[model samples]
Target: MIKNIIFDFGDVFINLDKQATYKELAKLGVTEVSEEMMQVYYRYEMGLITTKEFIDFYHKKFNIAKKDLINAWNAILLNFPLHRLEFLKELEKSSKYRLFLLSNTNELHISWIQNDWGNNLYQEFKNCFEQFYLSHEINLRKPNENIYEFVLGENNLLASETIFIDDTKENTDIAKNMGIHVWNINPETEDVVNLLNRKEFL
Candidate 1:
């Protein structure tokens, strides 16, 4: 019996273009995403680097303006539709499972979401979850075993009774290794609402 549900925010609920930001940056002459650039992004997601520092690192390295870089970085966050919001709200009404949100997100991304969705929409989204965990905010990220452990320990949730849903195979695999049930959903093909209705889960 799955008594808890952990959802990945980016594609599971809110839409994100994983390659859009990189494509935009490439247009600005950042033709390749180097390992060092990836490390910078990881550090930023871990909350070890400030937003200004992140922007400055790229700006100084690429000689791009702050605003232009910020726009490029934030291009991945597109929009949140009411249907998804309503689906979550309905899911919450069931009260059969404790819901949590876990996302590998950084400060700039979150700021963009807040601004784009506005406070009311954001609040409605938050209201659907028992706990909302962002990588930068918590200093932990998915695909890392420790993050799943942290959530389980912090919430006193049983691994066997929890279902973790994420778009990334790596994250889902990690959770499965820890005895948590997982749904490695493909947003392009699978519908989450239908997954929830499957007889196995219910």
Candidate 2:
């Protein structure tokens, strides 16, 4: 019996073009995602560095405009469907299980969401979750055992009685290995609104 649910924000609620940022960067002369660049990105996601420092590294390295870099970085974000908000609101109102959000997101992505979704709607979505953990805010990211352990320990949640839903296999695999139920959803074919009807719950 699942007593708690942890959901990923991107693709689960708000739609995302996962490759859009990379594609945008390519157009800006960042033709390759080097290992160093990836490491810097991970560090930025963990909030280990300031946003300016992150942007500046690329600015000084690539000589790209700061505004262009920010735009490309935020290209992954997309619209959040109103129906999903309604679904989440219903889920929250039901009070059937403790709900949480754990997302691997940075400041730029969040700013884009706030601007695109508006403050009111974003607040409503956030209020639905008992604990909303963003990677940049928490300095802990998914697919990391300690991060999952942190959530479980902090909330006193039983791993066996929790379900973790994410769009990425890497994240879900770690959760599943630790006794938590997982749904590695395919956003292209699946929707979060059908959570109740998913065979995992049934």
Instruction: Tell me, by lDDT, which candidate is best.
Output: 2
lDDT of candidates 1 onward, in order: 0.90, 0.94
> Which tens-of-lDDT digit does each residue in 45-130 have in candidate 2?
99999899999999999999999999999999888888988998999999998999999999988988999888998899999999
TM-scores, one per candidate: 0.97, 0.98
lDDT by residue (tens digit), candidate 1, 1-202: 8899999988888787989998999999999889999999999998999999999999999999899999999999876767878778888998989999999999999999999888998998998999999999999888899999999999999999999889999999999999999999898887566657765486
Worst 10 residues of 1 by lDDT: 191-200
- Give the C-alpha miss distance for residue 75 in model 1, angstroms: 0.9
Candidate 2: clashing pairs of residues: none
Q: Which portions of model 1 show Cα errors greater than 4 Å?
A: none
Compared with the true structure, the alpha-carbon lDDT of candidate 1 equals 0.90
